[model samples]
Target: MAIVRFVLCLMVEILVLPVTILQYVGIWDSLYKRVFPHLMCRMTTTINDKMGKVKKELFDKLPEFASSSGLTILEVGCGSGANFQFYPWDCKVICTDPNPNFQRLLESSGAKNEHVKLEKFLVASGEDLSPVASASVDAVVCTLVLCTAENVDAVLKEILRVLKPGGAFFFIEHVAADKMTWLHFIQHVIQPAWRYFGDGCYLTRDTRASLEKANFSQLNVKNIVAPLTSLIKYQIVGYAVK
Candidate 1:
């Protein structure tokens, strides 16, 4: 049995090797982008109800979330426009995503949320937001994105740079569970597979720590057990003001 297991593991490793190489060279991003919309469309359909409840919990608890009318908001990694319905009327939005394939979905969502102006759909990475002006945006929104960032620190710095002095960064992200727990152990074990299949999403990223380290003027983060699978159940939700 042990020998058989070893042989199976080696076979899996061989299959994954080419994908790892592609990811390293950035080709995997292009390939993933092409299929991401279809995959997410199905996923959103299934999880929309559950995710809606989670989003409401976060948005309701955060003050001024619905009243940020007329403010310019930047949404980093605005995947398929899942958060569009949450924005209030009269809030102008600038959305940036590395995948240009999301453009169609974004436009469709923008059309539905006619009140919120979709200022620009920049094909950009969160790590280097050169297209967005420093300290210009009133707020930044990120959800389930930091894990995939090439450099979380760089992304945080760029987010800080782009936000106005008193602007807020709203986020909801799955994070590493408490140490010594079975869930944590599983997360660590499945990280290699998860990161590859989940679009470079690391299962063990300490996103809250990164946010705190960025020295936000006010950090009101809360860890909650989301209605998701164990591997990604623990999520940090709230906003940090600059």
Candidate 2:
């Protein structure tokens, strides 16, 4: 079984060698950034359909939690603006992402979801949201993004920094499976390759634990298994208050 596993891993590595080489030579960024958004665009409908109800249940609360008449939300890692449709009507959104290539798709999504305003799009990572002011946003939304963060702790800190006092941080993230589970073992096995292929997404990250340690005044997290591939089926969904 060990030898079989080695051979399978070797085959997978061989299949991904070109991409690995491109990443090493710095050529992958140009291709990946452009291609990934389009791929996401294709998958957006299916994803939204599957996850829309839960997203709405969480996102709809933004208006009630807002300190102002109108809501101002800052979305970190806002790829393809997938969450745009879920925001409350007329709420302005400040979208930040490390990949600039998603801007066009984001704009397109904004156009389609006219109920929510796409206030601005900044080319920024979650770890550094400097363009946005401290305690400015009424809410921060991070969906399916923590897995890809280069620094989860730093990203959480930034989220806390930008949120107004009493502001809520809504999140939906796929987390590592329970320890000693078969899925956990598989996650460990594939994590290195998965990170490269999935754009820095760590398959085995204990995101809920990181969130707990971030010192949110209130946390209401729940785990659920979404109807997705087993690799990322285990997920956490809920909100934290600053």
Candidate 3:
């Protein structure tokens, strides 16, 4: 059954490759922007809530200092402000994303999570956060974002650059499975088309390796199976301190 599904999906992808290429070249960005926020908000909220203990464990590692007024947090790719509900009261967040269309959704969600203040919204990508000062943010929080970055290393470097010394980067991301297995092969095979459809999310990204290469002061990464399909079940969760 899985093989049949894979073949069917591959056939569909082959047929749509040209149109997908057009979308990648910027044809359907507006459409994606308009639809993705709502879809993502619903999807992430449902899944994160379903994995309540896991979500709490990840957020619990955030330093208590994060709740202080002077401390600032940088949230990379804060799509529809999904993490707002998990933040501690009094934490000020600077939300950054390439899509300006998410501003309205973010604002609406921010209103509901009043304990965490929305400091600013920057129309920027993770690769270059020049508007954000070096070592200016107290901590960085990124969830399910690295795989979509054009250059994951550059994005991690920028996160490192913006974080104050002793600050931590708390993250949760879907990653490639370990070992050369059938699941790994499937992930590798469908990655290109999957990335196109998933808004540049690469299913085969070994994010744990990228995090290690970034060379944080201390790292504690754990692998877990998310409540997702086989294509994105594997995940890395934990914090890396600067």
Local lDDT at 48 for model 3: 72
**Cα deviation of 131 in candidate 2 (Å)?**
0.5
Best model number under lDDT: 2
Q: lDDT tens digits, residues 131-192, model 2?
A: 99999999999988999998999999999999999999999999999986878877876765
**Cα-based RMSD of candidate 1:** 3.6
lDDT of 2 at 69: 64
Give TM per candidate. 0.88, 0.93, 0.90
In candidate 3, the residue pairs with backbone N, CA or C atoms under 3 Å apart (3 or more residues apart, or in different chains) clash, namely: none
Tens-place lDDT digits, model 1, residues 1-242: 44754565466667788888988898987788899877876676555567787776665443363334557889999877778777766778899999888899889889988877899999999998999999888789888889899899899999999988888898989899998686676666666667778878988899988888996889989898988777788999888888
Model 1's number of clashes is: 0
Report, for every candidate in turn, its global Cα lDDT versus the true structure: 0.82, 0.89, 0.84
Runs in model 2 with CA error above 4 Å?
A: 1-17
Off by over 4 Å in 1: 1-15, 22-27, 60-69
lDDT (C-alpha) at residue 178 in model 1: 93
- The order by descending TM-score is 2, 3, 1
